[model samples]
Target: MRKERILYIYPTLSSFIKGDAEILSREYEVTHFRVHPTSWHSLLRSLISQLFHLIFNLRKYDIVYIWFADYHSFLPTLFCKRFKKRCYIVAGGYDVCREKKYGYGSFTNPIRGFMTARSIKNCTTVIAVSKNIKQIIRHVFPSTNCVTIYNGVVLKPGKEDVEKESLVLTVSMASTAKNVFIKGIDRIIEVADLMQETKFILIGTERQLLEKIGYKIPDNLQVLGFVDHSHLQEIYSKSKVYCQLSRRESFCLALAEAMLYNCNPVITNIGGMPEVTGKNGFIINEYSAQNCSFVIKKALEAKTNSLGRERILSEFTIETRAEKILNLLESN
Candidate 1:
């Protein structure tokens, strides 16, 4: 049979929201829809564009693939259901972790009910990026099809990991996971306060509101605004340690990226952190200032060299993640 035509929908092209579904498109005839999914109202604008695409050429594609968080998949899945076409949704991370983290009371809590088991049952399969996400999918779908595949990360050698002077950087969205709460920013401040020798940097913006609300930023802590991967690489290359202390996460690309760069990671014991870090990188439990200080101190003391670098290369590489994902997708 001719290779199946696929259309993968994204929130926007500028979000830098990378996922494995796009990798499939590269091998097949994939049409990527970069939408702006800000709210339910945003769908109005998206529907206009998508309806045009659907009416004009929906039949040209064999599969309709949606790459986004929960509820957002409803748009594409609706088309597939109406047309009786085979489609798959890629639950990057949010589909699985968000509802659980925020609970059924939050603004997005309704996703728990609307984006339910029946949604997954109506499709061929839902691609979950992490094992935690796989479990979440199975919990929702129960008896439907669910496949767990990691996000791709290509490993490189010689660009080996090395400890920097006192540069600790956190590269991520300012608002994701309500960073104001249990995320590591507070602890980063605490860590910085404890060790005056280090400069704690919080990269990325979109959280100016929270930052203004007494986020406990200290003199040692540096808010570097937002820096892309090219700039981030230079920071990571010169950084000593990486920290990921999120209240919730499915598969953190930044954490994995930090590992590939060989920055010794000091992560919290939650969600996919333990799953990804394993015994490869330094890990911590509590997000308290006290605990953050302790963990940072310990990680800073450890040897950030070839040993940790080798582990991330062997496992978290994009090549390996892509191969796993492709094999899983092709097997079905």
Candidate 2:
């Protein structure tokens, strides 16, 4: 039997997409399409390129696997349905989320929502990253075929050997006020204020935005702008605790990666975070600075072990995800 040819569509070449794509390539003849645009000009150019590519070559492939139900996947999914080709759409967190405060989600924006809905309706299957997402899709489109599949993580084998400091860490794309609030940056700041003795390292873009908002960076908190994975690995090795107090998440890649470095997690009780933490880490029952501080303080005192890494190796590794996905694709 011949291997199936798949057209893999993604919004961006994000870490989340790359991890799964690496494994997907091994099983199928994958043609990866990155539709994330950097500017308005590039957006138009890329769409034109995609339209031409699909119009000419879409029939050559057997499956159209869309990573996110955004504009990029809309056209290809439509094409697949029109031509009666097998296609599935993978729901990344934001695409299927319906958060009122964030003012954005797959079904939040009128125009974008229509495109997303159409894409979902057209596809044969909707692979949600978490149980929460699966529930949301089933509630909205009760007849849609939605399945839960956890995103994969890159495994770092053999327990982390670095001696952990009293360092508490968090990583996010907190460049704006909305992002800060949505990512629980304010809560982290408040926790840092209360816990003067504990050192907090927040790694993300836009450290200056916090200053502008008069956040008054406490002496205990040090905001380091974006660092690549290599530097992140170094920080993760030295850190005793990792915090992800986000308002919502599909599947937090950072929390999983941090776990591989043996950093105990202190995350908010929302979205797919709990699934990622499993029973290995502490969960913040409330979305408050006081609650987050309590969890972090408690987590810091706990003995560090391979429990976090073990969780990833057993249930969330790239190979594990790939095998499940390959089996599902082959089933049809």
Candidate 3:
């Protein structure tokens, strides 16, 4: 069969610049239509030019892979409808499930609902990252065909004992921002600072507000911002835990990577995280920093290294997710 010319649309180039797109492209002729951070000068510019590109380019590819973003997905819907193409949407988080419940700021709730409704209605298929998201989509768009494909990372198990240290980690784009509203950064900071022995590393970008808070970030809590994806596995290998404090996530990719490296998870019991962690990690509901501390203690004590790594390797892999997507496309 001739290779399918797949056009993958994501809000930013970051998603495609990362592992998922590269891996997917190995099987399909993938082209990415993405917006970079430097390009968005103002709202008027983005609204007019970007939207035009998104709409006009819809007919160019045999298969259009739309990333799950409520705002961006709206513009593409115009093209999808106009061209009458087969499209598949990937729902990763918040915008798909949160916007309807809490509503996004500025953008009218009805508009988001309509855009999602169109994408859900017109797409060939919808891939929900977790069961929780699948349930929400089924509830919101009853007619849409949706499937659960958990996010994952390709793991190369390391030798040396990971017990080299007893440290917990929270990885995100927000660095040292006192108000880490996204991904529960503040909560992780609160939880990390309260605990003893367990060190926290804040990888990604740096935020100024975090330094002013006077939380007295000890020598243990290191903020190494913006790490390369290749280095993440090594970071996981040296540690004993991965903690994601975010209230909303479609699937915590970092948590999965940590699990693959034999680092147990101490994640918030939300979204697809519970499904991803399953029996391998400790889950905290909302707050309860005391509980976060306790669970990390227990996971450390249990020393479920081989078993935890096994779960991630068997169940979660980018290859597996890509294969699932391929199967769905071929089946249709």
Candidate 2 on 1-332: residue-level lDDT in tens? 78889988886787778877877788889998777556778877778889999999998999988888877778888899899998998897778766676875767777778888888889999999888889888998898988888888764653466788999999987667777888888888888999999999999856689988777889999998888877888888899999988887778888888998899999988888898889988988877777778889889999888877888888888788888888889887
Best by lDDT: 2
TM-scores for candidates 1 onward, in order: 0.86, 0.93, 0.85
Off by over 4 Å in 3: 15-17, 36-47, 50-58, 99-110, 160-162, 175-179, 205-209, 212-219
Model 1 Cα shift for residue 173 (angstroms): 1.1
TM-score for model 2?
Answer: 0.93
Candidate 1's C-alpha lDDT? 0.67
Superposed Cα deviation of residue 45, candidate 2 (Å): 3.3
Give the TM-score (vs. native) of candidate 1. Answer: 0.86
Which residue pairs in candidate 3 collide? 178-210, 183-246, 204-226
Model 1 bad stretches (over 4 Å)? 1-3, 14-22, 82-84, 98-108, 154-158, 161-163, 176-182
Residue-by-residue lDDT tens digits, candidate 3, 101-204: 33432124667667677767777778888898899888877888899887767556676464546777778765334225656776766777777566778777
In Å, residue 2's CA in model 3 sits off its true spot by 4.5
lDDT of 2: 0.84
Q: Judging by TM-score, tell me the better candidate of 1 and 2.
A: 2
- RMSD to the native, candidate 3? 3.2
Models, CA RMSD each: 3.1, 2.0, 3.2
- Give the 10-residue window scoring lowest on summed lDDT in candidate 2: 153-162
Instruction: Using TM-score, rank the candidates from best to worst.
Output: 2, 1, 3
